[model samples]
Target: MTQELGPLAREVAMSYYEDALPAHDRFHAKRVRDVSIRLANECDEPVDRDVLSAAAWLHDIGRPLERTNEIDDHDEWGAREAAALLEAEGVTSDRIEAVACCIRTHSIRSSSPEPETLEAKLLFDADKLDAVGARGLVRLACIVGERSGRTGERHAVIDDTSVFGTIASDQPDISLLRKWARERLDRLYTSPGRRLGESRWEFMEDFFAQFDAEIGVDGKR
Candidate 1:
């Protein structure tokens, strides 16, 4: 099943993500799909790899629309879009719903629906995994830089001497983003996900520690 649907899904995802933000581009979808399959192999229970693959590939298809304010919620909009796409591809209704469910809840947003199926949980975990480690920080920095109209100057957001001068003076967005990434370490639903997330979270901690030390925030300079 995946052998057939996977390529089509990738083709569709690439079209939507071609002009997406750096943080949520086609590469991000590929990473999530790869990680979802990798984690699925380690699970003790059976997993619907086809559903996971389709969901992972299509999960962020609506992000470009959301970025342009064409849609209010990417997760919700992506779910509906995935359903229609898969249905047109002649996928069964049950499988389409499973894919839709995974897309609907893959985000970390509080308002997003909770993932109930094993495939949904794995998709959520894989998506969050990409938002944590070294890669995660890079993605976050991209978002911050883009938002501040300082694209390509990530140091201003992640390693700025001014921003790190004092804990109280840290930019609110970066602070909230850091807190959000750290909290994902605990929100993982699977043991494998937790193990991987902890390692990534530790890297993030070390990075901030070095960042602070270099900026004299720790009084070491």
Candidate 2:
């Protein structure tokens, strides 16, 4: 099932992400797909790979619309759009609904639907996993850089092996990223997800600790 729909869904998702931000680009979707499959393999319960794959690929398709204020919620919008697109592709109603349900609740917004099924929970965990690790820092850096009008500076800081030495100690973006990462760490659902997230969270903490020490922040010498 996924063998056919996966490629088709990816192609459709790519079109939507053609001009997307670096943080939420098509590659981000691909990473989420990989994580979803990996987590699914570790689960004791059965998972519908077809629904998971389709949902992972199409999850962020409405991001561009949301970014432009054309839509208020990408998850909800993407779910509806995915259902229509899958229906057009001759997918069964149940499969389309399954995929849509996963997309509709992938994010942790208050208004977003709660993930009810194992597939949806996996998708949710996979998506959030990208927001807390080394990759998560890079994504947040890209976003913060873009917002602060310092993309080149932020890239330079990230590219440096001695980034701590070069980075500003009091940058608000770093604080924001830390806060967001902590929140994401607490939001993980599955046991496998929690295990993976805990490891990543530790890495992030170590990185930040070193960063603080190098820059003489947090009273570190």
Candidate 3:
């Protein structure tokens, strides 16, 4: 699998690195791939490794286009783009279709059909998992920075000019978002996904609690 895809997927992923946001770029795809593979190994049902691997790498390839409004739906565009890329890579037609399906429905926000196959579910789980952990906090920070016109390196520390710093200063609002994150943890599909999410979810909860206390908004507000 490494010989066949390790390089190609990395190359394909690099195409998005320069254009996409730091949080959702090639590195995000790699995290999803790692989590997806782990879930696939722990799944109760059988999952096709090739399809999952390809889909994980290609799933967010269309994010740049979506952000630019070149496509209204990243998932749809990603599915089509992934299919074409897989075909060009000499992957089997059936595998290409399966990979496309995984990309099409991996998004929890999109109107695309829910993940039906084992591979799709695992990919979905892996992808969403990144949005809830400590990684999730950092990703949220990047998003906040982007919205506030303060975009910079992925791992920048929080500051007044940064989004996370703004969030830290705003207690009541951040509390609401923390509530939303807590609820979202229940939405994980696969058992392994949920199992993995538990710790990340708790970590977020604890972080926010500490955040509230440190910021002097622990109980009153």
TM-score per candidate, chains pooled:
0.86, 0.85, 0.81
Q: Is candidate 2 or candidate 3 better by lDDT?
A: 2
- Higher-ranked by TM-score: 1 or 2: 1
Write candidate 2's Cα lDDT for 64-89 as tens digits. Answer: 88877799999989999999988887
Over 152-202, each residue of candidate 1 has an lDDT whose tens digit, in order, gives 333344444354356554345345557868777678898778888898888
Model 3, position 91: C-alpha lDDT score:
67
Tens digit per residue, CA lDDT, model 3, 1-221: 23565346556657765799886798899899999999888977887786788789888998888777789998988898877776677767787788889989987674778988888888988887887879887776666565555343232334223344343443234544455455556667899999998988889989977775685533333
Error of 3 at 119 (Å): 0.5
Order of models, best lDDT first:
2, 1, 3
lDDT against the true structure, per candidate, is: 0.82, 0.83, 0.75
Q: Considering summed lDDT, which 10 consecutive residues are worst modelled in model 3?
A: 153-162
Stretches of candidate 1 above 4 Å error? 1-3, 149-170, 173-177, 216-221
